[model samples]
Target: MDESSVRKMSPRRAAELLSKTPGEELSLQAWEGLREVCVSGMQDERLSADERIGWAAAGALVVDRMRDHSECADRRVAMASEARLRAYVITRFGREDDSSLRDLSLLIRRVVDAVGAESWVVADSADGWQRMTRHEMLELRRIKNLVTPFKSILPLLSPTDPLRDKIKEWVDIIPLLP
Candidate 1:
């Protein structure tokens, strides 16, 4: 049969046929379930930022996740295949051409360079680390020592420039695809 006809088959009927037939498309049917779960999770609006990170951290390619995770809601992994993941990085993110692994590596380098070597980090207990804007960090630092400090404590610097090596320790963003 053709793609559409097979897609329309009930899961039970498809499985029995696969057992009787040679090279039956059980894989495609399985993937359909996975894809549905992934699409549903992607559509969930109630996920928190950390929860979103958890989703990103699943590390499955959209195609794989769409295929496999749609099968089960609880077990979805982020982009599971490198080839598909690389394709997504190029297509969805800024890299249009030269989406090769090496090209992606280069883009990461450029981004790191643009951010500069020195900076202030603001950490939220639940929200993870954020590097404050230069102006905000400065005003916090300058006024922190003067006057009866009230709410500026959160804003002011503790005089730290979390080392470049430490910054490098950030969870590998490239791995998000596969």
Candidate 2:
């Protein structure tokens, strides 16, 4: 499909198309189309809650695909996708009473691991560290607020569940945030 058509497509239809596309490997065009559909869906305020969730799921799927196919040579794009997915989750669900928090935590961990210290560096200057610290502080506040209610139940997760570790790690690190 052309860019214009993809731009005008409904989130449901875009998700349907993405679902049909083989996951073994995605062509550049296919990936771009899916990305556009997801961004459009997220930005379009007329969509119902269900539609927005579907679009967010689509964005999550893209993040998962990027993680699985790490050699896709689009690290920056994947980072942006993950950031958008995280923001969508935070905006849609302010608490961690559901599985969406698990997804968001995992995405944040993945981005942190993939980008390393670079993710914390927003610019190249002595003052950049201050800006980065402010951003980290805000993220820490959001994460703490979202995960505190679920803290008691997090340990009950199976040892094999990666989110258990990720959440614990975040909880442990939040205390040291400046």
TM-score of each: 0.22, 0.50
In candidate 1, what are the lDDT values of residues 16-92, reduced to their tens digit?
44334322234545444433443333334575533332232232332333334334332212222322233233333
lDDT of 2 by residue, 22-53 (tens): 55467655665666667667656788866776
**Model 1, stretches more than 4 Å misplaced?**
1-26, 56-178
Best by lDDT: 2
Q: Which TM-score value belongs to model 1?
A: 0.22
Q: How much does each candidate deviate from the true structure in C-alpha RMSD?
A: 18.3, 9.1
Residue-pair clashes, model 1: 18
